[model samples]
Target: MNIKLIVLFFSLYCLFFVASILFPIDFNWYNSLHKPSYTPSGKTIGIIWAFLYSFISLSVCIVVSMVESFKKAKWFFILFIINYIFNQLFSFFQFEQKNILLATIDCGFVSVTAILLAITAYKHSKTSFILLIPYSLWSIFATYLNYNIYLLNI
Candidate 1:
């Protein structure tokens, strides 16, 4: 694809994250009460998300640019997008009704998808791989948060 397509793709990626934050959607009803042992404040979350999103955008650019021979690798990007969409849904179910099990499952899927994507990206582009580093680490951290929330709520 062209650079325009790649840029559009990355812009769309950040747009979704922005959409998620703009809404008052919560991830879990239990999350409101259960404090994470290492939960950062809202400000911290914003900063971290901004950084992660930047990394994700660059990695996505590389992925999109490499979409020819790496057609199979495209699944990694697809999964990444799917995870974000599902994550929003997960947050809806979690905050709307406190569905811990379902939310936990969603988190698990997202965590796994991100890790797998990270590996694929690493194998393809060194710059993209480096970009994915923080995202992978954060996914792991989010998994912990999701699991703990489930444990505390259930």
Candidate 2:
């Protein structure tokens, strides 16, 4: 495996990482909201996202390494890019903009794109697909949580 390619792929994921920092959660506003009893603590959510991002970075690296040509990885690439955009925007919508409804809608897009990216990566590398499974599941769960938050807040 090419270590440089792996680094490059992982670097691509930094966009969302940077966004999360830029749009750091506002605990004051967040704590004010009516959240579900099962809503995870901020620290728990942070830990989960850290793992998810690592998996996503590793999965993209695997797919990039296994594919013979860029064409083979194009769909996976496109889907992941879309997923990243939606993922990053969630912080902007939820924390920066403070719009739970928009955040909830963005979560749906993030979940759909994550699932599609995982499925698209399967043919190239099963390991990569497996790595993305948690990401897909997490995104879906996040969507559910966001939807509930929106409902409770409204």
Candidate 3:
């Protein structure tokens, strides 16, 4: 693996963490909300996100290193950008704005985009696709969780 590419992928992954910090979940506010019984604690959430980000970074590194064509690479990069946007949007809605409805919608978009990104990565590298499956699954679960919260609180 190219060290520079790995660094680049990891750097991009770190931006997601930065976004989370910029729009952090207010634990007091969150606790006050009517959350689902299935909701995990903040510590659990942090650990899961750490694993997910590591997997996502690895997948991105594989896809970037294995892409055979510029066209395929372009599509992969575009999908990644879109997915990141939705990811940040989810945080902005859920934590910063406290808009559960918008957050649920954003989570839905994140899930869909994650699946699409996995599919796109699959074309270039199976390892990349496989690595991304957990993140995609987590995104889907998060979408459901967010939607449930919206329904319950409404």
Candidate 4:
């Protein structure tokens, strides 16, 4: 039962990760954007995202299992789900159609999610907070990237 639950949650996380990859399938996607030379490559982004998702899944699983306060993880779970979906959807606003404004707005939401998750994790499970540090940092970076893209395109 426990193993199945773990598998289920991990599977869901991977589904979003894979969706992100395909959702940005247009090679022209990169070509359209005037990116910083320091911007990560597709392969680098893929690997980092995959690794981050794995950590997020494991940390959430641990928190859900160990935390006694259903109220705590419950709200955090909702926010986390919203954040994950928004993260995936940003690709649509960005690559498929190239709406830099919408993409920047989406990144704003992602930034909020990161802070909310960080606070919730810190309150509910100290160890979980560590797991999300990378996520928080990435959100900050992504916000800057999105802003730069919007400025460069428009």
Q: On a 0 to 100 scale, what is the lDDT of residue 5 in model 2?
A: 76
Write candidate 4's Cα lDDT for 1-154 as tens digits.
5986578667867776655667756776676668777788888877887777776776687678776776757878888888887888788877776778888899889888977887887867788889888988888888898788778777
Clashing pairs in 4: none
Candidate 3 on 29-118: residue-level lDDT in tens? 888888788998889888998988888888888876776666768888899889989988888898999999999999999999999999
- Tens-digit per-residue lDDT, 43-147, candidate 1: 787688788877777787777676675466867767777866765665565566567678678777767777777887876788888888887788778767877
Candidate of highest lDDT: 2
Model 2: per-residue Cα lDDT at residue 99 = 98
Top TM-score hit: 2
Query: Runs in model 4 with CA error above 4 Å?
Result: none
Clashes of 2: 0
Model 3 TM-score, all chains together = 0.94
Candidates sorted by TM-score, descending order? 2, 3, 4, 1
- The global C-alpha lDDT for each of the candidates, from Candidate 1 onward, is 0.71, 0.89, 0.87, 0.78
- Which parts of model 2 have CA positions greater than 4 angstroms off? none
Higher-TM-score candidate among 2 and 3?
Answer: 2
TM agreement with the true structure for every prediction? 0.77, 0.94, 0.94, 0.87
Better of 2 and 4 by lDDT: 2
Query: Candidate 4's error at 69, in angstroms?
Result: 6.1
lDDT of 2 by residue, 1-154 (tens): 6779767767866755887799988989999999899999999998998888888888888887788888978888889888888998999999999999999999999999999999998989999999999999999999999999999999
